[model samples]
Target: NSSDAFLLYRVNEAIRKSGAVVEFVREHIILENMVSIFGNTEKQAELINILFLPIVWGFFHIIKAFFSTPLSALSDKIGRKVTIIFGWTIYTSVYVSFALIVFLPSHIQIPVTFVLFTIYALFYAFTEGTEKALVADMVPEEKRGTAFGMYNLATGVSTLPASIIFGFLYTYFEQQFPGYGGTFAFGFGGSIALLSMILFSFLVKAKNR
Candidate 1:
């Protein structure tokens, strides 16, 4: 198979169980809730669609370059620990914002969701680049391959049950509760992220580079 086809196949396999959950969340949960939030359904969806299209179609190299240059420079100056801690700080903040938006009443402005998403993208840009650099600093050259392989494996293995559980919750609450599926996802993701940060903060000792 061609590289593109292979990547697509792998992505499909990895996300197989979660696909239904995502669709249900997007269509049934998020969209329905959004419609209630914004009385003008067409305008709200159109704005969201517009925002997502750029994220979907934008060039990876452009984004990678945007993130990489500053991070590469930062690593040289302040060291990896500071960079990682800073990245994690931004990452934690993004999840906290997501939880707030999801759990908050639907009476807020529709544009506010887009603002939160933009903030998420900014945090991802910083964390994504710094994370790899931090990994490279921690793992020796010979072990780098193994480190990345384990990372990929963990991501692949976790998705199946994650999707299934999310799917079940989405359907369950969406049926029983009119607009609570997102709240559940946000809370779940945020709580785990916060707990992870706390655990890692205590457990991980950063080396001086």
Candidate 2:
């Protein structure tokens, strides 16, 4: 069909938008990296001061291994909806906490900041482990390959615009609200929550399924 091409294009656009929103959030975080915000020497000194980089690497791999088993097993039992809700809830809470940390007085101890960041990682684990499973639940096994391919295409295509938008927002917010990265995090998390709600409403399973 001549119109099949047009429909695919529209589908691609929708996929792009969804991915762009996520990428926009990511780019904001990356752009706000302390190294970029400060400078190389400053970033190096800060990392050394905290011994952060190596510790972070070790910590994440450990956490990933620890969480992967339970999350995967839980998804099999409780179903994807519950797991996704838990994941998003955890994700939102972490972002809220992160945002609060930004607004917290600058004099707060480094350890306190580290704790907040760790909470963020904990939620990320839930999201990462469960999201693919949730997608599988929604798509038929026969179409899983196509669905995943489309999802990947959407992610890749949308990332460009997402990065651009996030860069714009991050710069604007930094100038306007200096030292308030947490507020941005809160906003992003809220947007995700809204999207989640909308998805719940619209993306229902078939009656037979």
lDDT of all predictions: 0.52, 0.51
Score residue 15 of candidate 1 by CA lDDT.
27
Q: Stretches of candidate 1 above 4 Å error?
A: 1-65, 100-110
Candidate 1 clashing pairs? none
Q: What global local distance difference test value does model 2 have? A: 0.51
Q: Candidate 2, clashing residue pairs?
A: 99-182
How does model 1 fare in lDDT?
Answer: 0.52
Clashes of each: 0, 1
- TM-scores for every candidate against the unseen true structure: 0.60, 0.62
Tens-place lDDT digits, model 2, residues 1-209: 01112212222232232342223323565533534445564453443333443454466467766776687567677766665567666655654554454334333423444464465456556656666666666787998888888867876787676545544554577688875432563466457665765586468542222
